[model samples]
Target: MSNVKDVIVKLTDVEKEFDGVKVVKKLNLEVRKGEFLTLLGPSGCGKTTTLRMIAGFSNVTSGEIELEGRNVADLKPNERDVNTVFQSYALFPHMNVEDNIAFGLVEKKVPKAEIKERVAEMIKLVQLEGLEKRRPAQMSGGQKQRVAIARALINRPKVLLLDEPLGALDLKLRKQMQLELKHLQQKLGITFIYVTHDQEEALTMSDRIAVMNDGVMEQIGTPDEVYNRPKTKFVAGFVGESNILESYVTQVDEDLLHISLESGKALLHAPGFKNEEMIYICVRPENLLLSETKKEHFSIRGRIVEHVFAGSVIKTVVELINGQKLRVARHPNEEEFEVGTYVYVYWHPKKAIIVHTVEEQIYNVIEGTTNRIYEQLGEKYSPSAREDSHDQ
Candidate 1:
């Protein structure tokens, strides 16, 4: 909730490699004070490696890491102003909850009275007041996790690093803990750098998400920004369900451009595209509309291959004449389309997002420059800008 723009942690051109294999490449990031920033990606995407580098568990191969504007590249784990809570909980099997929370302060040789007070405060902070006597073996997964967090926060570090701490819990407990963790971070006003591969968890808790892939940061923005306006094809496909259509520009009409499917069977309208240019268009499943009657523009004929009744919405798979398949999500209240039934799939031009192709993404990685496709589209065609235009 705090809007302070203070930079607590900065990673400048950070690179990490193991045995000549690069894991994190030219990564630049800044964690703002009192913000819940998540490093989100699939396994082996260098998210955990990045977090470990910040915590001083792993050394960076190149680049500098600064904590509170002071270079910490040479600092030891205990010397840095940060603490980490890992997925394994890392709670000592022989230690009780109170003892585990008090371990760090004890190591620091804090006075007995002060350590007791600090441990009590941490217990209340993590809502483990009544479980002080329980050991890791006696507590549930969620309880053990809280103990680990309390232990990490007991030091009052400038930043707290969490690497998939909730991954071991059941779905119901994980969802519950997500809200609790977000609320706790805001309450403590600590800069949290969380790492998770779960897209839903990242979206639910992060103020801003840094999406990484193959040793590079694909995108970093607020949840809505990354979800609605993904900068790359990988971001769009990985962050959520999307329908990617390959199309080529056919005609240009002032601000509006007409594009046709690669097979030249279906036509669509977009803003600010060049003629004869091939591009990828992304549309979220919920954005696609199904109609019995043809729409005025951007309408395609498809036969429903299957319809699934999810609790809140109906998911229908439609196949075009060219063999391209699209998944559509409709509100449960809408009429359902039976298999083999013909339907019109339509959407507004504003809902379509022009994203980078696989080749463009590769080129950007190789050249270390912004994609030319994005340069051509410009700021006016950006996801946020397009949303504003649609609202107007």
Candidate 2:
């Protein structure tokens, strides 16, 4: 409904506490007009709390919320010009699809003929043309969600908030809905603030993602940003699979930081480190390469302890000489490495990410440096660290 070049919504220093426990800490975020933004985190991470604050269902402890350059912190929920699609589908049991979609219009005092036309268009948009007369209970899970979405979008609100609208659907249906929602957001050009703990769903739909943890915002970026360049140990471990190897930073130069790992010494070139402190190395499972024979380049020798086929990729767990376990994910096409097989584990320097500890100052520094590095590196950093020698 609007161009993304405009700033549609803004939340500054937002916080919420319930029963003397802080549920949401100070959070600042901006929703670009017509952008699809998702609040992604586990339960109790304050995603729902943030959504409620925007919806006016919960009081803001302290902060300012602006909608289209106007302050809405003091406005009532109905006056904010935003609609929400709940996970429960909150459809009236007695109402049919058309009536459900038309309810918001009716409350706004739209004329009867225009209401009917809008409802008809919504039903067609959701591909539920012939099912307008069916009640919520009569429709399947996917259909009911469609009705919920249709109802929310029919109001032409400035922003639409969805709190895990697809959580109740089956696996196949949830995937289908993710794609549909993405397409819908792009087609309608309406600002969407979606909330969900399903990482895959967030990755699949959001134009940008705000990852929260322990009542605080962890990282905010595009899906690729959060996934690839995680700022903290929690973000790196929580967002995806990673082998977090604790290492000591031994040297630092321009665009390169050498570190010593427990397994052995290797060359690490992470750009985030300025101080030669103990840092954790984050390497994705897929980034690790498994070799039957040792190459002339940097590598660690380990024994394959287990091989688990997980549908799309094969997980090979290796025990290094120092007894640290490293996981490697490879495509299913390669010959499998069996249990107890000895192999060399290696990855390119760019695949390694040097992670600082989760202290407040360190966290802030990492968060601050990310944008600069991204502008310079063109993506996430690929870092490697040096170690003393291989043990096992």
Candidate 3:
């Protein structure tokens, strides 16, 4: 159990509206002190809107925001004990790095000696020690973003809000900055609220992630919780690569659930569902097992139609007897399956995440076409296909 003393920020029934569209709806969240929290979602999902409301830039249409046990609803942006690092970095081009970092101290009327000390400390903290004399125009994208973060941190605000601070950097630089920022957050012990659309970035850095969709929060939990046990279909689809299989509930008892797929029946052990209705099952890309032989209870035989080589993993697309296309990921070093190889697919029951909705017919048509292509290639060509391929 977590304690209130650990909570640095809390939102209760928080909501915001723009021109009568409910951009944020009845949101409840708690941020532990010194934790790195991220608001993650695609564009127009209300993640940015929610962050702005907390920063005091966007007013809350309803609900309360409490920071360190004080309601800050009436406070202006500058008056609130929070600082924001924008995507643009927003550094004054004319000001040198040292001065830009010192600007906040100057605004607060800190003594000259103290401001100098703080600026120097910030430069070292962000590992920009010797670059203080350079102007924003002279810095690299990563360096400029570091300067922006230094500027925000110099004030020593109770909370820091970062809005896609790494968006402008290239892939390599973005990944590098992610580690730097995460380490910096842990060292400083300041509550950090970051916003981004990148699911991988959020999973890599956040202590907890709030997944929002279409102006509503889908789920909020640790990366493991959200990733492994998504509460809704939107969350399952949005967070990572998932293969959703439509299934009908056949039996339900306590934590164990039995479901029947088009190819075969399998069991799921999620505790929250019951009543034996229709549901959807979700399996992660890596959780799926690719096999050459059929197994008891947990098996589906299919013809491999497409094999794509992604850098670290090989993606195999298989079509089951019922024309269901299932994707499985395997290591590059593993034996490669050809375009028309017949194989067996198996996955653990616990690895499946049962969902409650049906997929569109378009999926069926796309999968159906792939299966037919494999069949047309002729099954007698392969040594192993004589028994497996023609049986379908």
- For every model shown, the clashing-pair count is 0, 14, 2
TM-score against truth, every candidate: 0.89, 0.88, 0.86
Name the candidate, 1 or 3, with the larger lDDT value.
1
lDDT of 2 by residue, 42-132 (tens): 8979988888889989888888888888898679999988999999999999998889999999998999999989999988888898998
Which stretches in model 1 have alpha-carbon errors above 4 Å?
1-5, 263-271, 358-392
**Model 3, range 162-213, lDDT digits (tens) per residue?**
9999999999999999999999999998999999999999999999999888
Pick the winner on lDDT between candidates 1 and 2: 1
Candidate 2 deviant stretches above 4 angstroms: 1-5, 272-276, 292-299, 360-392
Candidate 1, residues 1-392, lDDT tens digits: the string is 22324888999999999999999999999889888999999999999999999999999999999998899978999999999999999889999999999999999999999999999999998899888899999999999999999999999998999999999999999999999999999999999999999999999999999999999998899999999999898899999899998878777877566777833333455665678988888999999887778766455778899888888988999998788899999888788777999888877777888899556867757644433444568977665565588798
Global lDDT for candidate 2?
0.84
Q: Pick the candidate with the highest lDDT.
A: 1
Compared with the true structure, all predictions reach lDDT values of 0.88, 0.84, 0.86
- Evaluated at residue 158, the lDDT of candidate 2 is 85
Report how far off residue 59 is in candidate 2 (Å).
Answer: 0.4
Ranking by TM-score: 1, 2, 3
